[model samples]
Target: MMNFTNQISTATDPAKIVDELAQGKAEDYNIGFLFVSGLSNTAMAEVIALLRKRLKVDHLLGCTCAGIIGSEAEIERLPASTLILGKLPGVKILPFSLNQTQFDDFQQVDDWLQFFNVFPNENPKFLILPDPFLFDMHEFLSGLNQVYPGCPVIGGLASGAMQPRENLLFINNESFEEGIVGVALVGNFSVSTIVSQGCRPIGQSYIVTRAENNIIYTLAGRPFIQVLEEVLQKATARDRLLAQEAIFLGIAMDEYTHNFKRGDFLIRTVIALDQSTGAGVITDYAKAGQTVQFHVRDAETATEDLNELLLSHRKKEQNKKPLGALVFSCNGRGENLFREKNHDISIIQKCVGPVPAAGFFCAGEIGPVGGSNFLHGFTNSIALFYPEEETAA
Candidate 1:
C-alpha cells in the first residue's frame, strides 16, 4: 500500500513553509518528494537543511522551480510547496546525484545496470530533476533507452535560474548548483505517463517526398511552401491567427498507422521558411519519406488537448483511481499561456479525480512520445502512480 500527502504554503519565510509541511507528515515514510519556489535566494540552503532534519524520510529528492504545483493550485512565483509519499512496503528507493562528468562514466548498459544494482527485469521507474543549463538530457536519455528500454523516467528540468550554476538541485540533504538529482524506484508500483504537447492537428497529413537534413523541401511531391499555402487557405480564421503566432509541424513517429491524429505525431516548431527556395527549417530533423502535418497552438487548443488526453486515460483505467501524480509543465504554460490561474493542475483534478499531485514549472519537460522519451518545451508531462494491486485489477 502507498500513502501520499501534498502541502503548499504561501509563506515567504522558509522556516514557516517547512513548519507547515512537517505539521502532520507520518514518521514512517521511506521517501519524500519536495519542490520549492518564490523563496529568497538566501533561503534555499536553509530551507533544504531544515526539511532534511524535520521530514526525516529515508530518502529525499527534489529541486527548486519557477513555480510549484500542489493540491489543485498552480502557485506561480510566490509559494513554497512539498509533496510527500510515504513508505512503500515492498519498494526499494535509491537516490543518486550525477554531474556531466559522472554521466560519462556509465558508457555501457551493463555498466548502468551494475551501478544501479538493477536487472533489466526489475522494471524500475526514475524521478529525475536536472539543471537544463549544465546537463545534456538528450544524450543521457538516448543511452537509457538502449539500456532500460521501456522504463518510465519522469520529471522536469529545473527552472528560475538565469544562467549556469544558478539553479538549485537537491538529493537527500545536499544541494548542488550544477548536476542532476533523482531516485530509482525498483519495486511494487507502476507509473503511467502522459505527455501533452498541447497542439491540435490543423491540416491533412502529407507525406514528405524530399528533404535535406533538417530542411523539408517537398511534401507529397510539392514544394513545402505550396503545402503551407494550401493549409492556410483552408484553415479557420482563428486557426490562421494562431498559425501566425505559433505554428508547428508534427512528424509522424509511427508511419505504420494508417490514420494520424493529434497524439500520433512528434510535434516540432516551424522555425523558418524560405519562399524563394520553397524549403522550411524545423527545430527537429525531418527525413524524406516520413509523414507530416501542420499544427496550430493556442489557449483553446491546449486546453482541449489536455482534457481529451486525461479523459481518455481515465476511461482506459476502468475507474481505478491513481494514488498520486507528478506533473512537469513547461514554464510557458500556466498563467502565461492559459491566462488563468491554476489551469493545468485544475484540469488534472477535474479529469484525474483529485488525487494528490505536485510538480513544478520546467524549462523543459521530459516524458515519452511515440514510445520514446524526448526533452520538450511548452509541453506538460505527467506521471500517474499506482500500486501493484490497483493495476493488476
Candidate 2:
C-alpha cells in the first residue's frame, strides 16, 4: 500500500512544525518529508532534527523555499513552511545527489542510483530535486529522460533563495551548494504522473524550413524574420506589442502527434529574435522540417491552462486519481505572474479535491510536453501516485 500526507505550518518555530506533523503521521512504513518554505536555515535545520527524533525514520530530507504547498491550500507568497510526507508501505527510499559536472558522468551518477535501484520491483518512480543553483536542469532533465526512459521522474527545482547561488539542495541530512538531490520511491506501487502546463494555443502551427542546432533560420521556406513578422500580425491586440516578452515558440517533435492541440506545444523560451532578420533563438535542438508555431501567454491563458488540465482529469474519475500530487511549477508563475493571490493552488484544489500536494516554485519546471518530458519554464508538473492494489493501470 502507498499513502502520502502533507502539512503546512505558519509557526515561526521549525520544531513546532515538525511536532505538529509527526502527530498526524502513520508509522507503518518508511517515511520521507520534503520540507520547504521556512525563513531560517538554522531554524529549518532545527525542524529536521526535531522530525528525525519524533518520527525516528532513517530518511528525512527537503530544503528551504520562498513558500510551500500542501493540501492544495497554502501561503501562495509569504513566510511559511510546507511538508510533503509519504508512507511507502512496501517501497524502499534511496537518497542521492548530483553536480552539473557529475551529470556528465552517468556511471558516477548510477553508482548513486544503486541504492535506489530496487529492480524486479519494476518501474519505480523517482522523486527528484535538482540544485537550480549549480546544475543546468534543462540538460540534466534530458539526460534523465535518456537514461530512465518511461520510468517516471517527478518533483521540481527547490525554491526559496533570492539568488541563484543561495538555492539549497539537500540529501537525507546534508546540504549541497551545487548538486541535485532526491529519493527513489521503489516498490510495488505503479506511479502515474501528469504535467499540467497552464497555457493555451493562441495561433496555428508553422513549419521550420531552415534551422541550426538551437536557432530557427526560417519557417515555411522563408526567412525566419519574415516568418515571425507574419506570425506577429495575427496575435491579439493586447499581446501584439509584448510579442518579445509574451511570444514563445512551440516546436513539434517526432514523439507526439502532428495535429496541434491546445496543450500539445513543447513550449520553449524565446531567447532572442532578429527584428531585422526574423530569426528566433530557443533552448532546444531545432532542425529543418520540425513543426513550429508562435504562441503567447498572459494571465488568462495561464489560468485557463490550469483549469483545462484539472477539469480533464476530474472528468475521468472512474479510476482513482493521485493519492498526492507533487506540483513543480515555475518561479515565473505564482502571484508575481498571476493577477490574483493563490491562483495556481486554488485551481488545483478546485479540481483535485485537496489530496496532499506540496512543492515550491522552481527556477525551471520539468514536465512532458507533446510526447516527451523536458525541463520546462512557466509550467507545472503534478505527479499522481495510487496504491498498486488500488489502481487499474
Candidate 3:
C-alpha cells in the first residue's frame, strides 16, 4: 500500500511552523519533500532539522522557492512551508547530490549510473532540485535523457534567490546552496506527468525548410518573417494583438505523428526576429524538416490549456487514481499571470480530486514531453504518484 499526506504552515516562527506540520497521525514516512518560501537560509536549516528529527523520514529532498503550493492554497511571497510525506511498502529510495565540479566530470552513461548506483534496467523516476544560477540545466537534462531513456525526470529549479548560493537545496538532514539534489524511486511505483506549456496554437503548421541551430531562416521555403506576417494577417483581431508580446513557437516533437494539434508540439519562446532578413530566433534548436507553428499565451489560454490536460489525465487514469502529487509551477504564473490566486492548484483539485500535493514556484519547471525531458518556463510540471499492482510469480 502507498500512503501520502501533505501539510502547510504560514507561521513566521520556525518552531511553530514545524509544530503545525507535525500535528497528525504518526506514520513512518519513507520519503519526503519540502518546499519553503520567505525563509532565510538559517531558518530553513532549522526547519529541515526539526522535520527530520520529528518525522524520521529516511529520504528527504526539497528546495526553497519564491512561493509554496500546498494542497489547499497557493502562498506567494510569504513566510510559508509545505511538506509531503509518503509511506511506500515496496519501493527503493536513493538520494544523491552533485556539485558543478562533479557534474562537469560526468562524461558517459556509466558515470551517471555509477553516481546513482542504479542500473538502467531498474527504471527509476527522479525528483531533482537545482540552484538556478549555478546549474547548467540543459546539459544536466540531456545527460539524464541519454543515460536513462524513457525514465521520467520531474522537479523544478530553486527560486527566490537574487544571486548564486542564495537558494537552498535539502537532502536528508543537510542543506546546500550551490549544487543539485535529488532522489531516485526504484520500485513498486508509477509516476504520471502533466506538462502544461500554457499556450494555444495559432496559424497553420509549416515545415522548417531552412534553419541553423536556434535560428529559423525559412518556413516552407518562405522567409520566416514573411510566414509570421501572413499568419498575423490571417489571425483574429484579438490574436493579432496578443502576438505582439505573447508570441511563441511550437516544434512538433514527433515527426512521424500526422494531424498534429494542441499537446502535440513542444513550445519554445520566440526571443527575437530579424525584420529585414525575415529570420527568427527561438529558445531551442530547430533543424530542417521539423514541423513548426506559432503560438500565443494569455490568462485564458493558460487556464484552458491546464484544464484540458488535467481532464485528459483524469480520463486516462480512471482505474488507478493518484495518491499524491508534486507541482512545479513557473514563477511567472500564479496571481501574476492568472489575475487570481490559486488558479493552477484549484483547477488541479477540481479535476484530480484533492490528492496530497506540495511544491513551489520554480525558476524553471522540468518534465518530459514526447518521451524526452526538457526544462521549460511559464509551465506547470506535475508528477502524480500511483501504486503499482503486484504481479504473479
Specify the highest-lDDT model's number: 3
Model 2 Cα lDDT, one tens digit per residue, 1-393: 566777777777776777767775756436565656756667776777777777746676677666676775556566676777777777767777777786666565454346356542365567777766767777666655665565667777767676665766666668776677787676677555567655555566777888888988888878876767776687777667566566678776542466676566787767887777677788788988888777777777778878877787666655356677777777777777885666787888787766777777776666665445677778878776667744422
Model 1 RMSD vs true structure? 2.0
Clashes of 1: 0
Residue 133 displacement in candidate 2 (angstroms): 2.0
How much lDDT does each candidate structure score? 0.83, 0.69, 0.89
> If scored against the real structure, what TM-score would every candidate get?
0.95, 0.89, 0.97
Model 1 off-target regions past 4 Å? Answer: 389-393
Segments in model 2 whose C-alpha atoms lie over 4 Å from true places: 107-121, 241-244, 255-258, 317-319, 389-393
Model 2 scores a TM of: 0.89
Number of the candidate with higher lDDT, 1 or 2: 1
**Could you tell which candidate, 2 or 3, scores higher by lDDT?**
3
lDDT of 3 by residue, 18-119 (tens): 899888837788888988999998898898888777886788889889999999899998889999999877899889998989999998888898999988
The worst-scoring run of ten residues by lDDT in candidate 1 lies at 384-393
Best by TM-score: 3
